[model samples]
Target: MSGRKAELVEQVARIRDLDLRLLDRVSREALTLDRNWMVEYARWQSGNWQTMSLYNDSGDPSDVAIRDCEARETTVLEHMPATRELLRSFGLKYMWVRIARLPANTFLWEHSDYRDLADLERHRLHIPLHTNRSATLTLGGARVHLGYGSLWRLVPTNRHGACNLSGPDRLHIIMDCYADDTFRDLTSNLTLDDNDIQWLPEATDGEISAHLDEAVALGKLGYHQAAEHSLLKLFYQYSMPEGMGYDLVIRAYEMMGEHARAEQWRLEKKVKLCLA
Candidate 1:
């Protein structure tokens, strides 16, 4: 098995314990839902809009998507720190949650964590949360039952999809992991240096993946201009001009509460050559 794969299993086990603890502090009624993000994003694509009601089919042994829960409405990503901290008992960090509802006959489209990070790895952990009894969880092409207090891991990079068969509401609380001191020591303090230019994954559906790959290369080569240009070319509709939006990136990183890392990138500019 790959080192990343092993890391995933270990993290998942730790998170499961945390999940059990979280159920005690949380109430099935406490889970809240909102759709601001969904409506706004969907409106950008098309003017049609719908306010979705949050449902709780998670209690059902068998759940269905459309008939049980309406997915078109925006789902909220609530910050549950106590639940997040519980994962730390086993040494985990970085957490987020999304309460997903799939009415009967509804299917979650294929997706992965790859789009979430520029520095994605296959070893991260995922904790599936289903508080509803009728809710049935499926992953990696299989059906797995997770009771009210049960939690499970999902490696998104692998070919995976999900379905809810219980005619009720369900919530999927997923979290990701990174290598801690143990992993760093095992890797002998390895690092990922930059490159001059990296080609996009040809089959990436002209997605952000290619541009991100190029951006990393440009940053490594200290070619901020070219990198920004490529990003502009790829994300043409973005607010700032291409190859000149490091400030925007800095702001976003700041919003995500990653000031140190953002500052580190700014320091990378120190080595860059400036024109007279």
Candidate 2:
């Protein structure tokens, strides 16, 4: 498991399939509306959480960016084809989207997505629309420096923060994705939302299994780093005495030029502990 764990670390550095240009094409125009809505929502609610969220960002200089969820109505999320594709590939469900406007020389305080304390797949995703080479996000112990035309996502699963050292006002988009029951029973949760959407929680094997499947898919898609990171965050539930659960980690190791380490994990026995 330790060797596998080492492999997992390397996997996270190599994933780059998320097309920033494609996302930029959609978000450049779409950002105005989303930013406006967030501003308006912040003004009206002040402290109250809005749709698919817990609170609106006030663009406050003193405020550090955070994720928010709605009051009640939507507890579980339904998915569209495109969103489902992301969920299947990432092994998490989308709920609310968040954006933060950070001033220069500012950074968010470090924090982790508390297991079971938050919801399932409970983490944050960030994308920069406008920022210079100085914008960066520090995840786990590694600081991922962001440049134009890059896509990066991380679980609040570990402690993380952001730094805006550049001159431009850092514009970042955050989408919250959760893990839930029905979502876990199958590969992808394809139902569309007729009303409100709920974030899923990771409580049962169904949810955990779905996440593992998603991790595998992500690894296969060459988002090896993202997949391995997901697996590591889910360490408590996914790890079994059988141990081959770290197959993605092995792949990640090989990708990072750790063939010997990868071979070590490959020699371990594979085990899946079904909690029933």
For each candidate in the order shown, give its overall lDDT on alpha carbons. Answer: 0.36, 0.43
lDDT of 2 by residue, 1-276 (tens): 345333333322222435654556534533343322223223111122212222234422122234444311111112123222333444445455544566675544333343324444543445555776565554433345544444444545544445555556666555554556633443222221111111122346676557667766776677765665565444322222223335546755665566875676454312111111
Q: How does candidate 1 score on lDDT?
A: 0.36
Candidate 2 contains a number of clashing pairs equal to 13
lDDT of 1 by residue, 1-276 (tens): 445334433322222234455665543423443332122222111122222222222422112121212122112212435443444444432322233444443334222334433554424433344434334333222233444554455545543333444445455544334446743333332221112111122224355555566665665676654554444333222222222334444443454455785695455333221110
Question: TM-score of model 1 relative to the true fold?
Answer: 0.38
Candidate 2 residue spans exceeding 4 A from truth: 1-15, 19-21, 30-92, 114-119, 180-276
**Highest-scoring model, lDDT:** 2
Q: What are the TM-scores, per candidate, against the unseen true structure? A: 0.38, 0.40
After superposition, the stretches of candidate 1 with alpha carbons farther than 4 Å from their true spots are: 1-15, 18-22, 33-91, 95-99, 122-129, 132-141, 181-276
Top of the candidates by TM-score: 2
